[model samples]
Target: MKIFYFTGTGNSLYVAKRIGAEVYSIPQMIKEGRYEFEDEAIGFVFPCYGFGMAKMISNYIKKSKFKSNYFFAIMTYGGKSASGLHNMEEIAAKSGIHFNYTNEIMMVDNFLPAFEMESEIKNKSSDEIEKKIVQIEKDISARKNQLIRKGVASDVLSKYVHKIADNVSKNFAYKQIKVNDSCNGCRVCEQVCPANNISVTKTPEFSHHCEACLSCIHHCPQNAMHLKSEKSKARFINPNIQLKEIINANCQVK
Candidate 1:
């Protein structure tokens, strides 16, 4: 089995590792244009962005060709998944692939401006989420009922939300990432960025294709990267996810 994913705070990575399948990051796969799967089962694991799938995942699915008997997806959301699964299914259909399973798991909301949770609540919620994921895995193993129907109204609303988010993501000017005086440039942020958006100059520099995935902001070893907002102080990364785990989790072989 092969699981392809794009993770920011590592909720998607956690699920991918637990499945014990070969994993690939969608951004890396898209950039390299390499698609060779020996596994019969193929899966996508990603966070629900803007009530739908991430643009990276959608673009990869649209362009890449794969031969596999089983196709599945496991989407992790901070709150509600909404029409994320539906959007992915639509993409799969366009790609001429049939999805055998689609599942959603609620994880800690790391999107600071939109949603914030108390530390205690976040910890408790993550524990509950892991339990739900275990159940989802069992269901997939048994080949049980997997598809969740989305009503026409829900689909329309989700599409509208996704459109707004896409515009915002593309048009919005991002705040510069600053490293404080207490800095030793370990270059961890540059290494972990899935977009290849960060580089170690005198300090770290952000490239134009910032997915706002915050992998750099969250994984900085020296606590160096910061956004120019008051929320920067309050913003927290999920403690359960480590950068080493994210990297070491089997994605793909070079």
Candidate 2:
């Protein structure tokens, strides 16, 4: 089994690790310019973005070729999964790909423009989340044939919302990432950026091709990265994930 994952704040990476298998980072895969795969079971795990998925994830699905007996996707969300799974199915169908199982897991909402990181971490129930993941593991082990279905109206609405999200990403707060006086040119942001969007010298430089995943901001050791639109000063990275792991999984500099 091979699992491909995309993460910003480690929520999806944590789930990918817990699933247990040869996991691949979608960002790293893109960096290597490799996408073809053959496996008994293949899985995609990533956090939901704007009721859809990261543009990189979407493009990867639309462009890649895969041969597998079973394919699955796990979408980890900080708030609502909404039509994320449905959206994935729609995108996959266009590529003549199908998923055997699909599910969602709620975790800390790291979107700083909306929720406070402290409250999000405090309110999340680890036990409840684990219970859900345990069930998903059992089901996937059995190669269960299940897909999330939604109302036609909502599904249609989601497509529009997804487009809006794409636009939001382009013009979002990170469109012009700011570095504070605290920055010591540690370059942690450059190392953690999945998009290869940051370059470091005395400070960080964003290459406009940003995914707005916020990995750079969340993983920055000095917490010097910030956006004017952000609602709180707090940041988050999944407790189960370490900085080095994130660097290994996402660094495109090398």
Q: Estimate each model's TM-score.
A: 0.85, 0.96
Q: Write the per-residue lDDT of candidate 1 for residues 1-254, one digit (tens) a residue.
A: 78898887687887887877787877667666775554678888988888887676787788778778788888887766778788888887998878888888877766655554465244656567778878877876776656776788888888889878766553222454567875677777777666666667567766566666666666766676666542434445556667776554322223
- What's the C-alpha lDDT at position 188 in model 1? 70
Residue 187, candidate 2: C-alpha displacement in angstroms: 0.7
* Candidate 2: pairs in clash: none
lDDT (CA) per prediction: 0.71, 0.86
